[model samples]
Target: MRLMRKSRRARFWMSVVVAFVILSFLLSIVSYVWAAVDEVFVLSIDGAIDPAVASYIERGFKEAESVGARAVLLEINTPGGAVDSALRIRNRMDESPLQTIVLVKHSALSAGSLIALAGDVLVMRPGSTIGAAEPRWVIPGSEPRPVDAKTLSAWKAEMEGTASAHGRDARIAAGMVDVDMEIEGVKSRGELLTLTAEQARELGMCDAVQGTRQQALKFCGLGSCSQNEVNMGAAEHMARVMTNPLVAGLFLMVGIALLVIEFFTLGWGIPGTLGLICIGLFFGGHLVAGLAGWESVVLFLLGVVLLLLEILVVPGFGIPGIAGLVALGVSVFLAVGSVEQALITLAIAGVGAVLLVILALRFIEKRNYWPRFILMDRQSSQEGYTSRETGYDRYVGQQGEALTVLRPSGTALIDGERLDVVSEGDFVEPGQKVRIVKVEGLRIVVRPEK
Candidate 1:
């Protein structure tokens, strides 16, 4: 009986030990499961769907795929952008292995509409607008005109086909591209169809309507998932600025002006360095954005070299200079890949350079700063000037006041002496500070003092 009692005690202790081990193992498994948090990625794409935006979306998709995300959210808000850029973005989204849900915050017109259709699921905010995917051909110095029937026909077919693939209304999609396409009760002739959020749902184009991105996650059954937002990097912002029409024009003008200044100054200092940087950015940014390929960059470099050779090696504005200008213009046109864009840049730079030169001559020339940098000075006898001012050389750097308005000819008060002076095209008000840039006998060329 004593042996039986000891055996019972041993069995009970063994059972307790086994139970404790099992409980510990279950607790560890539960802890691990709780430690692994769910993550969802939000890819925010706003503004025009240019190459920069397309590149951003591509990078966002790759990053989302790499992280094993629960869902890839496309936060879209744009009016529209380049057709080619939009198509590239659509292709990237279509090829992504991860599920992509397009959440349109505001208007998704034109290219934006097409990209929205590429997603696995389409959604929009209440009262948000979408559709209007018409394609128009733009010509420089004139209003935009419609494309040929064949091109329009092809685009309409493409739009319809994309919608059909997603089980949406093909007729409605085609109507967005062709104004002639009437949607019976929804739209009439001579109008491209744009739909509100509720209209999109009724038309079976959009999947759901949600106000914010969190609501979208909850709608998708991933409400509790942690979110990761993808954003533009420094390089992407630089690319956007480089590609912008206004900014690109400004860059071109700055480049041209700086180079001109460098040539005039002839010392290759700050102006030369700044000029090179502006030109480099114009080429480098476009090159990275896929707008300017290596060929355009090569052509641009060759053109710049030829222009430099003409200036430094030949030392004259001759045939080489003209050829260089042509080459550079052609390269810029190719780099931007459009005639209209190229003309815009050229016009802005041309006009901007003139204005800049005028301002520099007016405001900066008075400081005698140009003379410090330039090696030569001009002498005009017709304006009443001599090579050597016998007694007026002492007044060369003297500061004085304009006693009368100078419209290339004025009177000045210098050292309490009334003297007749000639201004250099800068209108100087009476009582304004004046500096003597050149003195020839009685003709003193004065400018507004810095």
Candidate 2:
């Protein structure tokens, strides 16, 4: 009986140990399963929906899928952005495996309206507006105006295509692009169709109306899911700013202005350094924004190096300087967009820089900034700076033999002494007879003996 009882006790302890092991395994797996909970990712489509915005949204969708998100929500507030960027966003939305839900928090004008339509379900906030999706072309220095008929027709078709793909009324989207489309109830001739939240829902354009973001998500059957908000990094923001035509022009102007100032002044000072930095930012920002690339930057840098060599070592503005200027102009114009845009941006920046520099020189220089930075002290004999002056005036009218071939300036043997001399607009070979004609300070001018 004692042996049986001991055997029973051992079995019971073994069973308890096995149970504990199973429970621990289950507990570990529970955390993993919990971590795989449903997610509703929200990305803020704020400001101008440019290339940067499209890139950010594309990345957000990728991340959402990696974690098996339930749905992707876009919170939009924009007065439109780039047409290409909007189209890219629309393509991405159409291809995404997870459904997209767009919540229009404010205005969805122009490109914004097209992006909002790309979603599986579009919810609008109360009293918010949507539509007015005409394609407007902006020349940098002038006002923005409508695109030409050929371009306008193509844009109208694109809008209609996008709307039709999502089962919305094609005519309604057409009215947004072409003012003369004349939708019977929503729009008339010579007028673009812009709809309020209520009107959008009535026209079958908007899925529903919700006051808050949370309510909108709940309506989409994604209530209680964890919300993942995708935010923009600092670099992205800078890139977006650089994509602006005016901003890009400003960057180029500042860079060029500072560089000019540096060249005119002595030594490589603050202006030169700052100019380089601004130029770098100009290129870097455009590259990040996908407007320019490494090739443009490389070309620009090569041009600058050549120009610097010409200025600091070669003594004149020759091939390198001209090439550098061309390269710089090409690179800058590339960053600012099309020809009209580039011209406008350049004009604005150039005019503004000239005005600002003039104002600074005329009035602002003596105040605080320029006065502190300017080096007023002269380098003279009293200040411990001196030149070699071995009574060079006495050498005038003296005959000499060229010791070194004078490519305008070389050494010559004068009165049994070697002296540094310069020819007056002539090249003299070695062993040639020469006579000193002028002397001022330490400079002694010579001419080949006639």
Cα error, residue 387 of model 2, in Å, equals: 7.6
Worst 10 residues of 1 by lDDT: 31-40
TM-score, structure 2 vs. true = 0.73
- On the 0 to 100 scale, the lDDT of residue 133 in model 1 is 86
Off by over 4 Å in 1: 1-37, 136-151, 293-295, 312-323, 354-368, 376-450
lDDT of 1: 0.82
In candidate 2, residue 79 scores what lDDT? 96
Q: Model 1 over residues 1-450: C-alpha lDDT tens digits?
A: 999999999999999999999999999877655433377778877888877787788888888777667678888889887777888888888788777888999988988998888778898999898898898765434787887899788878877887888789999999899998777898999999999999999999999999998888788887898888889888887887787766777787888787777777756788778877987888777776778888877887788788888766653266788888888888889877677788888788779977876776666577778767876655667877647546877788888999877765768998777778888888888899998899766678888986
lDDT by residue (146-265, candidate 2, tens digit) is 899998888788888988888788888888888887766677799889999999999999899999989998898877878888897787888888777778778877877787676656
Report the error of model 1 at residue 158, Å: 3.3
lDDT of each: 0.82, 0.82
Best by the lDDT measure:
2
